[model samples]
Target: MADPSNYTYPSPLEGYEGLEPLPDEKETEGPNAKAFINPPSKTLSKAYNQFADPITNDTRGGFDIHIYYLQTNASELKFAAELHERIRREFPELRIYRLFEGPVGPHPIAMFEVNVFTPQQFGAFVAWLVINRGPLSVLVHPNTGDDVRDHSQRATWMGQPIPLQIGFLKEMLKRKEQEGQTNGS
Candidate 1:
């Protein structure tokens, strides 16, 4: 073994062994140099195709944001209605579904669904909801062609998360897979 005290230490910048030295201005400015590379296109990022997942082909911002409230609570019901109206008035571009008075699908409480097709839309709506949503629970999940996983594992929540009855979703997927196999055979 080499003696630690006698061994030569490599320079901290040894990895830049053959790289060109920095420009005179950059060297003089040190870390304060205003160096940045602008994107090729005018827009910073792609508007339509954002999500890149190998499991599913839904790359074009396929996501469902469900805002939930208890129908039994009159105040909550009223707030949800007003919230729905406000969302429609503010963001008419979003595909906002009608308010369900009762539990629908896997949701254990009354909720309304809004669909966002772009990263910008998702970001903006979520930000807006974060400020505006009062006493409401929101469930945001991607549509990766796997309903059970989307609702359970990949789901994002705002406020207190309500338990989802995903057993039905699992059953539905199982049925679909069986049907596909039967047809293929």
Candidate 2:
């Protein structure tokens, strides 16, 4: 076998020249400076807008952290119970929902839902979960107005991905759209 240190990997963008060249520092003086001096909005960061003084929009505040464990396994159930209690004890400010004994909503396994309203909470909780969530799966998804998209497309999984029953969500969305049409006309 060849020496691994002697081999060099080719750049992914080596042959790809489809993008435009970046502007020089001098070219971004007037408009950029004016914009920086006077921002479009008072709160430009999504973190602030979503949590503090949230603007009425499609997406909701913060994210949902679903901790799923196998109800069949005795050890996993005990661990999940301990984890749930630990989370409640540690992050008392967070809106931690009641633990479900069986599958509920789109979730296919026994799990507990925790709602974090701020970016700080989101970061801290997720980081903690990363280290502590052993032999358990987590589904972290944003509460975008569109539940189907949020649960399906925008979901982030920790460990193995659990199959979600989002068909009901799709039907719910369709019914809502139909109602909106009927009300408008």
Candidate 3:
């Protein structure tokens, strides 16, 4: 993870909070504020960013995941509970899954975003999704402020993660067998 200290303060988020999005038509600015096209609004803004995520890709090639969730009218806690149950029953391989229901009011759209380790994991997730799927993929925006990623943090644990469970003796024995075979010449 890149050090939060390394970043310039008042992240790109600060300006966004009060920003009212322009209409899909051509942007017209106020007499003082100039209008510019938000490229993300125009083009599908799909650049990989690694400064804040797992995997060692230089933003573009890094292992990244974002999943979008939308609810018409929901109790976040209840939704999270139901989401957890679905994971446990449907996709057990996804050992740790998380859901975040953001603060309500003003911003009316309920932003439910989930992040996981790998694409394989997410694919499995989609397969097991019993309830909701939306057109949007989860996106990780640049972090600003105190900078702990509370919204997208992990939430559910289906089971123990799969790991290569080789004993020390097994590893040593395998190595010795390889050595002995090599020396037969």
Which candidate's lDDT is highest?
1
- After superposition on all CA atoms, what RMSD does each candidate show versus the true structure? 11.6, 12.1, 15.8
* Positional deviation of residue 129's Cα in model 1 after best superposition, in angstroms: 0.7
Q: What's the true lDDT of residue 165 in model 2?
A: 85
lDDT of 3 by residue, 1-185 (tens): 23445445555575368767665554566663455555465543233212233333232322222333345445544554565565567655444345445423111233343433444554455444423532333333222222222112322222221111224334655677799999993
Candidate 3 residue-wise lDDT at 104: 31
Report lDDT per candidate.
0.79, 0.77, 0.39
Ranking by TM-score: 1, 2, 3
Per-residue C-alpha lDDT of model 1 across residues 1-185, encoded as one tens digit per residue: 11346434567675558866545443235585566433245555343457544223343347899999999999999999999999999999988999999988788899999988777787899999999999999998888876776787778899999898888667777888999999995
Q: Residue 83 of candidate 1: its Cα lDDT?
A: 99
Order by lDDT, highest first = 1, 2, 3
Better of 1 and 2 by lDDT: 1
For lDDT, candidate 2 versus 3, the one ahead is 2
Relative to the unseen true structure, what is the C-alpha lDDT of residue 171 in candidate 2, on a scale of 0 to 100?
77
Give TM-scores for every candidate, taking all chains together and pairing residue i with residue i.
Answer: 0.68, 0.66, 0.26
In model 3, pairs of residues that clash are 48-59, 57-62, 66-138, 67-138, 97-156, 98-155
Q: Summarize candidate 2's per-residue lDDT along 6-101 as a digit string, tens digits.
A: 445566676547866544334347665633333235555665444432222333446888999899989989999999999999999888888798
